[model samples]
Target: MTYTARSIVWIVIYLLFILLPLFALLAGSLPPARDFWTEFSAALGYSGLAIMGLQFGLTARFRYVTEPWGEDVIYHFHRRISLFAVA
Candidate 1:
């Protein structure tokens, strides 16, 4: 499969957004002083919500984000993410 420069850029942007929270957590103070499971679960929830929101935005049909992968690919990805959201 071929990817345009814009598409490659979009991929990096998406990945960075997904990692934003982890980077935030790591770049800040140590959290071991806090409840591990509680913080971990909260982080997971926040990450999942962010991913879900991105999934919706991915369907906005913007050529810059969807062109390299195509509309069908984006829609299928959205469908898969929707299923994942229920879990």
Candidate 2:
């Protein structure tokens, strides 16, 4: 699949805003206190996993692109993320 520059930028922004924090939680690397980090990480990880699953379901339902430029870019990112979630 070919990714446009807009799609790449949106995906990067999505990762920064959504995925990065979740990843830190999953890794128990979010700072301040190590003891609490693990528990917080566990909780956030579960929530993040649930959100990811929901996104996957929604994206998988979209078999074709029908939106305009920005929305289409978002769908493309969603499709890519859905694939990553499956893996």
Candidate 3:
């Protein structure tokens, strides 16, 4: 695929990785329903963990993965997302 296509594919994969855990959690048996903020907070916590975990892959410098976006852009995204995940 072209660079743009590869980049889009990677973006989709990243989103799926982050969301898969939330989906799995919802799919399984759960406790009684809670307030909206409580559920929202839980979802945010899961997403943050996923983002933080993916940082390792980002910094691994896989040529095919980084080629589409360039190492600089990838690192920039990594830094920004790290901050976001922390927040």
Candidate 4:
């Protein structure tokens, strides 16, 4: 499938959250320090904000479809990621 810009952004998110963090904990040997909770929380917050940004873009760019099947796309992605994570 040809990935559009929206797909690219979420692919980046997957890299940042699912891939980078995984490596950070394993290969990187990065310990969660005393202030790790704050850092981790901020990272999570950024991830959420990224999703919000995508949502805003999706709404602005696809208002017609957003009115009809927008949420289905979101759920579809969510389900795909869920299965991906499970694998």
How far off is residue 37 in model 1, in Å?
1.8
Clashes of each: 0, 0, 0, 0
lDDT of 1 by residue, 1-87 (tens): 446666778778987887797778788877666687898887888778778879868989997677788899889988987788657
Give the distance in Å from residue 66's predicted Cα in candidate 2 to where it truly belongs.
Answer: 7.6
Model 1, global lDDT: 0.80
Please give the lDDT score for candidate 4. Answer: 0.54
Per-residue error for 49 in candidate 4, Å, reads 19
Comparison by lDDT, 3 against 4, better one: 3
> What would the per-residue lDDT of candidate 2 be over residues 1-87, giving only the tens digit for each residue?
455764566456545655555665567655565587786766566556655855754455444332224456557766786666555
In the range 1-87, model 3's lDDT, one tens digit per residue, is 887789889999999999998998989897577998998999999999999999999999999778998999999999999999998
Using alpha carbons, what is the TM-score of model 2?
Answer: 0.34
Regions more than 4 Å wrong, model 3: none
Clashing pairs in 4: none
Candidate 2's displacement at residue 44, Å, is 2.3
lDDT of 4 by residue, 25-63 (tens): 455555556597886765565545545445444445455
Where does candidate 2 have its weakest 10-residue lDDT segment? 61-70
Using TM-score as the yardstick, the better of models 3 and 4 is: 3
